[model samples]
Target: MYFSGLVSFLIKYNHLLLLLLSLEFMALSLYYGLFLFLSMMDYEFFFSMLFLVLSVSEGVLGLGILVMMVRSHGNDYLMSFSFLW
Candidate 1:
């Protein structure tokens, strides 16, 4: 699942929304793997909780950027931005 998300991210770079979604997908897969590892190890779940919190915050930040991009540029296409040069 993680690899699939990465492939999507690499192949779908035309749109900011698609990139963010792929990133979130990758993060979710990592969270699931971490949770399983912790469970099998009989370790505390605090780390997993922290990881989830961080991933959610990261997703929120990405969405906020997406919103700003859409509002200013009128679309989510990455190529819509003008070059600084």
Candidate 2:
């Protein structure tokens, strides 16, 4: 997705808030696109619905984590974290 590419670029450049926003945009686009393809068989439609739910939940969780990171660290650049050392 184009939003995913933007997210990667933002992450690479240490733009944390922008990365989270782009991730949300990507997930929203995925939900809309998947919803339009519901003309398939029953089983396939069910699987697509399941994937849509998972993606929405994943995006929400990611945003929550990012908010916590910003609160704890005063910023959210992934590269700024050094706990690995």
Candidate 3:
């Protein structure tokens, strides 16, 4: 699932929304794997909780950036932004 998300992220680079979605998908897969591993090993869930918190913050930051990009450029297309500008 993570690999699929990565592939999509790379292939769908034309849209910032798709890239963000792919990143969220990858984060989710990682969280699930971490939770399962910790549970099976009988370890504490503190680490998983920390990871979840960090991921949520990262997602919020991504969305904020997306909103700003869309507002400034009127769209979420990645190719619309030129580095040489």
Candidate 4:
């Protein structure tokens, strides 16, 4: 199925949320991959968990910045950045 114009627009403009979601997808995929590899090779899972935690923390921080900016400016457009200074 293809996304409609509104979905595409959201993905284009809501970059921070999009990035966070992408990171979450990556982290989940990596965990699954690591689990499969470990089942085959017999290694510990701590490293994969660590990476997942780091990605989550990064997403949290990124979303926090996005929320703060939106709260301050009342807009999510890139043009709002000019008001930063």
Candidate 5:
């Protein structure tokens, strides 16, 4: 529910900052779900650590995207994005 709310907010806002924040929230929610499932299964903490590393990697990637978006558009908006051939 919380993550879905974040998704809705991102869709309505549709800007780079919101996109990055939403991605973090999404990753956190996934980590929570994974932790719960692994705990129930008696899995090791190593899986949670792996997820934490993944979340950090996701933050880096999302920030990279935001930087590129700023460089290309000089502002945050969906319309400013374009594809290259």
Candidate 6:
């Protein structure tokens, strides 16, 4: 419910790029928070590095998808994806 609400809010007022960015921010924050918690327990940076690497890869993939979406739709608005549903 919370995530759906966030998606709706992002769709209603944000550009597609902004939507992707916000998603990325949310993911990174969650991962980094975990990493910090883990670090405090054992001072290990490995988990954070692993998550950072993963997040970057996820970012690249998301960006590639965004590019494809824009090319196919010619616009970056959430409403433009109505055809998908």
lDDT of each: 0.92, 0.70, 0.92, 0.67, 0.77, 0.74
In candidate 2, residue 74 scores what lDDT? Answer: 82
lDDT of 1 by residue, 1-85 (tens): 9999999999999998999999999999999999999999999999999999999999999999889888988998777688511
What's model 3's overall lDDT? 0.92
Count of clashing pairs, candidate 4: 0
lDDT of 2: 0.70
Query: Which ten-residue region of model 2 has the weakest summed lDDT?
Result: 35-44
User: Per-residue CA lDDT of candidate 2, range 1-85, in tens?
Assistant: 7566565756655766666667667766776677666654333577677877787788788788888887888887777878722
Clashing pairs in 4: none
Which window of 10 residues has the lowest lDDT sum in candidate 6? Answer: 1-10
- For candidate 1, list the clashing residue pairs, or say none: none
RMSD per model, one decimal: 1.4, 3.5, 1.4, 5.4, 2.8, 3.9
Cα lDDT tens digits, model 5, 1-85, are 4569476665866576776776677778888888889999998889789889988998998788878878977977766567521
Off by over 4 Å in 5: 2-6
Worst 10 residues of 3 by lDDT: 76-85
lDDT of 3 by residue, 1-85 (tens): 8999899999999988999999999999999999999999999999999999999999999999999998988998887798513
lDDT of 5 at 63: 85
Q: What does candidate 5 score on TM?
A: 0.72
Candidate 6 lDDT, 1-85, residue by residue in tens: 3365467546655476776676677776677678769877887787778888887998899789879888998878766688755
Model 1 whole-model lDDT (C-alpha atoms)? 0.92
Q: Give the candidate number with the greatest lDDT.
A: 3
Residue-level error in angstroms, candidate 6, position 78? 2.3
lDDT of 4 by residue, 1-85 (tens): 0234335445666454555555556566667777789878988888877977887887788789879877987755664587643
Better of 1 and 4 by TM-score: 1
